[model samples]
Target chain A: MLHELQSGFMAAVLTGSQTELTSVTPKIREGKLNTAQRVAIYRRNVQSTLRGALGDIFPTTRWMLGDDKFLNVGDQFILHAPSTSGDLNQFGRSFPEFLSAMQPSAAADMAALDWAWHEAFHAAEQAALDLSRLGAVPAEQHAALVFQLHPSARLIGSAYPLLELWQAHQNSEEAPLEISKILPADHHFLAVHRDDANVTLTPLSAPQFHFLKICAEHQPLGEAAEAAFALDANFALQAFLIQTVQQNIVIDFNEPS
Target chain B: MSPHHQSSRPPHALDPLCAGIGLRPPHYQALLGKPAAVGFLEIHSENFFGAGGPPRRYLDKFREDYAISAHGVGLSLGSADRLNPAHLENLKKLIDWLQPSLVSDHLCWVGVNGRYLNDLLPIPYTEESLKHVASHIRQTQDYLSRQMLVENVSSYLEFADSTIPEWDFLREVAQQTGCGILLDVNNIYVNSINHGFDAMQYLDAMQGADIGEIHLAGFQDTGEILIDTHGAAVSDAVWALYASAINRFGAIPTLIEWDTDIPTLDVLLAEAEKANVMLEQASFAMPTREGRRHAT
Candidate 1:
């Protein structure tokens, strides 16, 4: 009976429908506030809490869409895809996909980048690889070594200039550029990672992005370099490797067994 | 229950009479630059569920000076469905890491049927619900191998099928599970107003309860009902109630919890100082229990 009441209360809160309240309303005491009013308060709290979680993660998207539009979209998404986890941090993983389906716009791309930045901010902290260790490996064995990206590193390729969009929204005083006015790139690659206390977004060229992507997939250094070379004849593997290692993106490496 | 593994680290002790504040992100830098004058810092355990990040880094930094309280908001201990193992695992990880002076969550459910509403939803005060919550609390204490404080939540409505008083229900759950009570004085005041019960009566009933910690927070008055928003300053009435709680419970570790529209470190510390004043004025001294354990 308690389970039945909880199910009914949940339905009443989620659906906000009178029909769903038949089982719940009778079970609620009639005080200064009627059962409907009392249930409505809970419904509001649930919606606002979920919306606040989304808003916190995707502030750039919220700024792009403005408060009213964002709230409307957030309300719909709350009903469409209710949170499965008790942790609010894990609530909006599918929000960008939902937005992509709802409207194929740059805002959806921005939401994806926001999600990436959020993940990077909260991902496990791993130590950057010591270049000396790489130097110690025999030059011949280096080809077989599989490099790994930092646990917090995420590679995102988008059609929109997400890094610039996110940066533009950082300063609340500055007016946001119109999405139509901003030029969309054919392919924009980015490396999102947490450096110490801040989350940083570094733009990447196609070859560089692919190289890191390959490494992230656990490919050997030689294979990743070859893939990068295939994209561009002069991919500059050594220079890029040094840059990534310095940036603390490539955190560790494993030798071939 | 024996700890799954004993922590070699020494326990961080908190003064039972001193007040503390909730550690929010905005005041991290400020708190770190110059540690606030408080006994401990309370953090919502779920916020640091991530493997590692700035939160964990800052918490570690704060831990050096202050005792930490791993207060959880997502355990859903009162839900009819079975407790979530993943949530329990994450909570255990945080507790093991922080080894907080106190760990607590609401005496209410946040979700059921695997879908989290993410709000402190009230539960009916029935024999069935009491047994369910008590069992979950027991399981949680066993899993974590430590005592946990369960706090009362403010509710706008009451259940028609409830067969027990709220105070009796909370007391019975603690008695059944051997869990300590984290009495939120503000909630008692809010619930008293909304449900037309005497606030002093609720405190009177909890006189002998294992009051491990006290929560002092602000609430929003919607004219018709009081909402535990925890945004504004703690009201004079709630302060009065907190003083009464301190007098009754004998200087329990108090925390000034501000979750939304969080103010600067100074403002929170000021509120904590207010609670500290009350704590200092207490004439009685209840024998403080160190890590209230669950009965095996």
Candidate 2:
């Protein structure tokens, strides 16, 4: 009886659906205090709490859409998707996908990119790249150096001017944002990494994106070089490795066979 | 190392009689240089789950000065799915890093069916639910290699199939498993009022020795239903219950918890000072021949 009442109570709280709390020791009547009024408190709490979590996770998306529209969208997300972890940081893992299917928006792809950036920011940390280990590789292998991006590094490809959208929405005071006259363009590559304890994004060339993606898979330099070459044969492996190592994005490296 | 050698003796903090307050962000800067009189500080473990940040930085410094407790909200231990190894791993890391005096989580499931309610929903006090929660707590203790406390949450409704009283279910869970009780006094008061039970009766049913800590917080009364909002000042009713809890349990390390509309640092410290006074009065006062003295 305890299980039935509590489960029914939660169901009513979660969906605002009517549930009779029978089998309780005193048998609670829905009409005892007007079931709708009784259940409204929990429903308000659940929705408000979830909306606050979504606001934290998708601040950029919220900024792109005005507060009222964003809340409207939030209500839809809450009704359609239920959070799977008590951690609010994990609340929006599916939000990018949700954006992909939501009602038409001029900046839908940009919203997806922003959500991805938030994920990378809170990702687990890794030790910086060890230069001593790289020294152990033969001096002859320097030209073929392939480096591993930290587990937190992510690559986002989007067709909208997401970088501009993200830049305008930053907590900093910038010139007024003008998304008016913008249209979706060809897919652009973006490199997202946590540096100085803050997640940052930089535009990447096709070759640069593929190269990091390959190295991120722990592929050795030689194989990763071939993949990079497929995109742009003129890809400079040495220069790329130097830049990546300096950025603290590359944490470890392996020899290519 | 052998299992015996690997296991460190349970951490030693203040005696259970001490009263403390939750250290929140608003209080962080002020607490840094000030002298702390409270017994300990309890923080939500998930608030510091991420890598290095201000929360970790402040907690590290604070732990050095005060006994600390890591109270968790996201373990979801009672779910049908296996305990989340990742969540446990993060908790273990925090435990190792901070070396808190006590660790605890709710006695209810917040996530299931691939959806997390992100709120503590009550468990049916049936043998089946008990077994599931007990095994999960046992496994969590083994993995963390420490005895953790499980807290009873405020629930809006009771389950129909529950076979035992809520207090008995809680006490038995502690007895059957070696896990301790967090014993949130405010929750007891809230549940008692919501369910039409005597709060003192619930306290009497608990094993005082098994309680590792106590929690005091404020709740919002919506007339029709009381919500454990953790906002505003501790109500007179909850304070009365706190006095009762301290009398029965002999001052188990109490905590003043305020999470929403968090007031100024001075305001929180003032609240903590009030709890300290109550603890002192409860300890010094003699138990009358007619049971405990009702505080004036």
Q: Taking the tens digit of each residue's C-alpha lDDT, what string does model 1 give over A115-222?
A: 988888878777777899988988999899999898889998888878777877886635567656665668999999887657889999999999999999998988
What is the lDDT for A216 in model 2? 78
lDDT of 2 by residue, B59-164 (tens): 7677767888999998887776678878888888778777788999999887765567777767777788888889999999999999999999997766445678
Off by over 4 Å in 2: A1-12, A18-38, A103-107, A130-136, A142-146, A171-181, A226-237, B1-12, B15-18, B23-30, B33-38, B51-58, B77-82, B286-296
Error of 1 at A97 (Å): 0.7
DockQ, 0 to 1 scale, candidate 1: 0.55
10 residues in a row with least lDDT, candidate 2 chain B: B1-10
TM, every model: 0.94, 0.85
Error of 2 at B16 (Å): 4.7
Positional deviation of B20 in candidate 1, in angstroms? Answer: 0.8
- On a 0 to 100 scale, what is the lDDT of residue B2 in model 1? 15
Scored by lDDT, model 1 comes in at 0.85
Winner by TM-score = 1
Per-prediction DockQ, in order? 0.55, 0.30
Residue A34 miss distance in model 1 (angstroms)? 0.3
Best-fitting candidate, measured by DockQ? 1
Name the 10 consecutive residues with the lowest summed lDDT in model 2 chain A. Answer: A20-29
